[model samples]
Target: MMEIQGIDLSIIWSIIIAFGIMMYVILDGFDLGLGILFPFISDAQERDVMMNTVAPVWDGNETWIVFGAAAMYGAFPLAYSLIFEALYLPLIFVLAGLILRGVAFEFRFKATAEKRHIWDKAFIGGSVLATFFQGVALGTYVSGIPVVDRQFAGGAFDWLAPFPLFCGIGLLLTYALLGSTWLLIKTEGMLESRMRHYSRPLAYLLAWVIVITCGWTAYLQQDIAQRWLHGSHWMLTCAVVVLAVIALYGLQRSLRLRHSHKPFVATLGLVFLGYAGLVISIWPNIVPPSVDLWQAASPTTSQLFALIGTLFILPVILMYTLWGYHVFRGKVQVGDAYH
Candidate 1:
């Protein structure tokens, strides 16, 4: 690998970390959003159709999260140690919920008439639980992951604080908004119309949550707040502004058009922008004030080693993702089966 001021590995590795997390957010995020939209759906047929909307891609979507975590562990051992130690219980719950949702999703179709509701409940419950915990985790990121003496020095339940709780709710609303948009694009008839009707309101709600969370985050970390509110972090602030505009405009356009992919993509752009804001807000600090990307990054040799595999696999993942979506393009008929 090329070396520049001996910082060659750091630059490449930072890109890798950023890319991995972005991939996770963009990929797993929607499926989690799909789960969040679960309760909004009425009628068993509509729920099944909603579930089917994501069935083909949901599992594939979640893979990026695993890829992200694995990349963190491999590239930034220190960050992995700190985050894993601090977020262990919540992570466990998150994994369990995801597992339950994945299994129950498949099993619900095969379940006997008597046990079908059981599976349905499992699916919904699992989705809610998983999404909530993941949101809580996001809040923890904003609140700061606990660290002491270069190691995680906080309780497992530290993630369950009040601010994190609010963040969890915010994430729930955001995911629901995404699911609603996806429904507008993927399904048709009354269900799609209902989903479209729900989109703007849900997006508005999510925007409220975002404002509240930003305020709370600023309150908790005055310095970070100043950085965000002031013109210090101009680029990231610009991203947030752009995201807000896109989200609002896209929602309006989608509402007018009734069903189009642009709004969904715009919603995804909002997600990207939101995540970028968070990352920028916590610059030079991975766990905040305790560790940074450079501090947490592995040695040059290991990073280089991993880059080889990443270079090969990343394209393949992208190709398959695009191909899958391409093949599944157009509205899905409710009578059609997910499997």
Candidate 2:
């Protein structure tokens, strides 16, 4: 098997999965954020416009998660099993939420006034459930789930902890920030005005949660803290930190200056910064201290086949994704819902 400067196919596959995971979090994240922000909107027309902004492309956003999961299962079956076993309950809840969200998206548009409220609530509830549990699962992953003999050894409620709960709240606020910026771009009139007002505070709140979460993660994990604080890694960590700060400032500045695209761009930058930091801190180790990427990777033959298929298919996916976004581009007015 050929190697790219000693980096094997396994590492390449891992990077592919990592990129897919990041895309899922950032893309679908905004829609989930919008759904979570629904209760704050009392005006039904405003809510409809907000939902319409994401209607044409929301399901497509979720496809990235499926790609990520499939890559994980195929490329790193051991790590995937460990994660699934440890997170089975939260994963189940997340799936239920996604299903409910899909159903709510269709029914809300056709319902009577009173029934629309019910469907709207279902949408919001699903978004909240999914985002909160995702955060919780992340916290569990960061804090380290118990494993024995290559399997999850923790109880069902083992992930129920203060840090996970805080992470849940943090995720909710982060999504809210994304949703608000998204609304500012896709809406007009009083709704857009309200979103612009809310986006700034949400940005500030997201910054706070990010700071606290990073500090807590550092304090909590000795190995990660040591690696991140030492040598060139520390410098890279500092650079990422600076970028995060700039992103936060840009988000607020764009909101103030009424730049339609800048706020969302900056928001995506912040999300990427966080994802990069997490990946750097956990590099090589797909499941932290116990299992490195190489140890968990599938055989080289499997990886070669997968990589070949990925090379052929990924560009096509990217092209259509780009085209879809372009086709759906523009602000969603009150009565302009696609379906």
Candidate 3:
């Protein structure tokens, strides 16, 4: 265990927690987004291809969520309590959707064509519900978590506000971009070509929505703009912009060259850069201006206890994820082949 200005070893654990959450969002988020875009494929064969694109990896991908939640519960008990209490309904909905989707995922394989159609719809619905609510939860945090004496003072619908709603839409488009990129990488021929064509237009639209949403957010909370533009945090905004430009250009070139790998890799980089910008821009504030990291964290002893297990488990998870992807890294097939 190391110390930073005599801060507890738990701070490292907090970093791990943050890392897990962001990683989960970027990894599992694309698959969920792909699942969300399932309905748009129109053709059942293409839909099956999309489904197979993520089937092998989706369940494993969700492990990060567990890691993140456990880390938060152990290292930041206050934050865990506050978020769960405040966002109980949304969390419940997210969990329900995830469970339904997971079940529907397997059921779709066993069910007949008609029953499979129902399960497919269920999976898509579940994915959308979970994805949208996750966005709403983030939006609530951005807008600020209502607090009174370290407890939630807001209603259940507090997260469904206008700014949060826009953020939700932003998240939707963001995921759609992710889905398109995944399709570009995982499929070939006509489907891959279609995904490639769809990606740029979707990315452009998502970029527009994101810019407008950020502007709207700044308008709503003047401090966000003030901090983003004139404060010490301006560098993050520049970084995000530069990365976005690079990602866009790379995506354009990838489409032209029909590169299977470039677009997904570039999009992943863009997502990480954007997520990192958000994290840095809002550091030391777990629940924004009201709650600082240290104040939200668990006791040092409790954190040390959690660290023991995380240290053992984290590397295993990392190794397995890398190995799984390495094993499955190739063109996904449609029709009666196993994924």
Candidate 4:
């Protein structure tokens, strides 16, 4: 109920934070997916082209993660603290993977045969570690972080579970689909053809993973199930499912037709729809079972202060980001530099 200028800052920050999360998932998700798919491509030149595709925009893509975390800490201190505490181990590893991958990006481009190969491995491993942990964290969050007396009461490794593992695999597949579709948009000839060949399989895999994860979450979490099983919310859930299925179908068709942009758009739509459904299912809840968004929100003053900067700077960031993409649009080739 905290208000600022007649508007609820809690809801404002929540929307802003959700937007940041979605952007991070879409932007950084593709590059990390490309990194995960790196090792599978035997040709060194192919890897170079893949790296080049993301090079101009990769650093910018990752900025949203930092923004999201910091904003949550400022706007929803309790939820941020509890979620981070519950995910301490996984968060540490996620940071480490991101760092390792950043370093590998530099070294792999500069080193000779042997050292480059080693760095390449590092790049793949790092991306896998980061993306997997992110997915695990998502699953753990959805399952609910243990809370006692309004504070985190879970063990460090509480998130280490079969459901989280399955989620990790599912997220990895989803990201790979995004990456492959992006490659289709940013590549041509042999690499693009290879991506087209791979897109159908990745799409199918992602579709199943989404279904399984949705079923598991619904079955295990009563509130979430109820959200889907009753009321008009069920219609919303059905719409999301239908939307995802349509996107997948469209993606496959786009790949077949060699539509450079449609596959990427379709894949992004699936991710967006899935994300939207999850948010809808857990609307008021921040950390789950009982920690509703209002309960987890920070003071109105804090949110208002944060919004001053966010409201001003976010649009600027968005503008520049779009401009950068426009400048870098078109196919990326093997000889292009990482920058």
Candidate 5:
């Protein structure tokens, strides 16, 4: 395997894939959260404003997931195949939800008043379904898949467990909180105030869920628990917890101060911290319990080739994404339309 400064190409690819997934989560998460928040918003104009806030950048945000998946396929074909095999059902449902949501997002604007409510329902249902199943997939992955000889050996319904279900609910709340903080940044007047009101409770619920999920995850997987609680790993765990507390405190302070951007920034910090913790817990394991990065990685030649393309393309994606957000930077009004 090729090495750069003694670091394996597989490890580098792992980092790239992880970064892509993180970008997807933080970027698309808020838009998905907007859909989840749709039910709470009764006023048609308010919903319009909420949708418009994300309309300019939402579709572009999904590019990261595609990037991540493609990177995995090119750089870690073994792990990619195994993971997809294990997660086939949930992944299919995730695609379905995304399709539904995308269709609703476009049609909702074009629909008449009578038909708009149907699209509204589609948006909400799609968002909830996608978020929930994504969580289930995460939980299932964390719990470990049964892989035998590089093939998935698990049952199709293995994901339908208590832990995964709780995770599904937890993720729903997490996205709702993200959406609320995002609204705080992109809105004003009564909508902003309502989002502010919603943000606190959502944050509180998310905090509880995070704590419980951590404990549950630890209890359910001894290897992970040892990784988190034993040896020098405990310090990293402490740092993550400290950072989480700080983020939570900052969020509350920002909300109290009525600072629009700070709340969203703090929320992003919390999400990053959680994502960092997950990576730390499962470091080097592209597929836990068996497959390490090296085991799952494609040939060094393939990884190097893909890495070159990724290096060239990733910056372009980032540049344009930033440009889009910059162009649309402002409070979205009711009449605003990105479609």
Candidate 6:
């Protein structure tokens, strides 16, 4: 394996993939949340304003998913192939939803006033479709995929289960919370107040979902249960639970205090803690219950080559993403046109 000093290149690549996925979830997640929130805001003008808040940077947010997928394909082909094969159905739906959502996002602006509702429905449907399946995919992954002889050995409908379906609901609430907090940052007047009102319930619901999901996950996966319930890892589990509670409390308090930015920041903290906890649970396993990073990794030379290019490209992506957000900073009013 390629090494920089003593660190395995596969490990380095895993971190890179993890970072990309986290960034995608936090960034693209809120935009998807906006689509999920469309049904709640009956006023067409308010919906437009909500969409505008994310218009400037939403497409850029999706780049991380592409980057992560490419990194996984190049750095860990075995795991990539197995995962994709196992998740082909949900992933296909995710892609279809994303395509529909993207099309609706652009076309909604050009659409006639009477016909705009069509696009709105499309947008909402696409967003919910994408987010739900993504959650299902995550839950299915966590529960584990059947693999044998270095290939996927699971049935076509293996992912259809109550736990995965429940996880779909959990992610919808999670993203809705993110969306409301984002609006708290990017809107004002009645809209801001409405978002604040919506955020409180979303936060509470999300907290419950997180707790239930964690418990369900532990019940289904004994290895994960042991990791969190026994040994030194138990301390990490406690820390994660405590930090999640603190973040949830901060989010609720920030909303109550009408601190616009604090609510979003706190939501981000909660999202990060959740992501971190997942990582802690499945450390060293790109494919859970079976494949470790090294076993699933590509050859050393392939990893080294990809790492070199990724190091150069990642910074550019970050720079441009930051610049785009900087230029678009501040409230998106009803009259504003970001598209």
TM-score of each: 0.93, 0.96, 0.93, 0.97, 0.98, 0.98
The most accurate candidate by lDDT is: 6
Q: What is the Å distance of residue 130 in model 3 from its true position?
A: 1.1
| CA-only RMSD, every prediction | 2.1, 1.6, 2.1, 1.1, 1.1, 1.0
lDDT of 1 at 15: 71
The reply for model 3, stretches above 4 Å from the true place, is 1-10
Clashes per candidate (backbone, < 3 Å): 0, 0, 0, 0, 0, 0
Every candidate's lDDT: 0.78, 0.86, 0.80, 0.89, 0.91, 0.92
Which lDDT tens digits does candidate 4 get at residues 1-339? Answer: 888568888888889999999999999999999988886788988899999988888889988988899999999999999999999998898999999999998888889887788999999999999999999998898988879998898898888999998888998998888899899889888888888898899999888898889889988898899988678988898899888889988998988888989999999999999999889878888888779878988888888888998989899879988998999999887777774
- Candidate 2 has its poorest 10 consecutive residues by lDDT at 1-10
Error of 1 at 130 (Å): 0.9
Candidate 3 lDDT score relative to the true structure: 0.80
- Name the better of 1 and 4 by lDDT: 4
List of clashing residue pairs for candidate 5: none
What range of 10 consecutive residues in model 3 has the weakest lDDT sum? 1-10
Off by over 4 Å in 4: none
lDDT of 2 by residue, 1-339 (tens): 335467588878888999888888888899999989898899988888999898888998998899899889888898999888888888898899999999999999889897899999999999999999999888888887666787777888867888877888888888888888888788889998888888888888889999999889888888889978887899989999999998998888888899888998999999899989988788868887578887788887787778888888778877877888899888888788646
Give, for candidate 5, the lowest lDDT window spanning 10 residues: 1-10
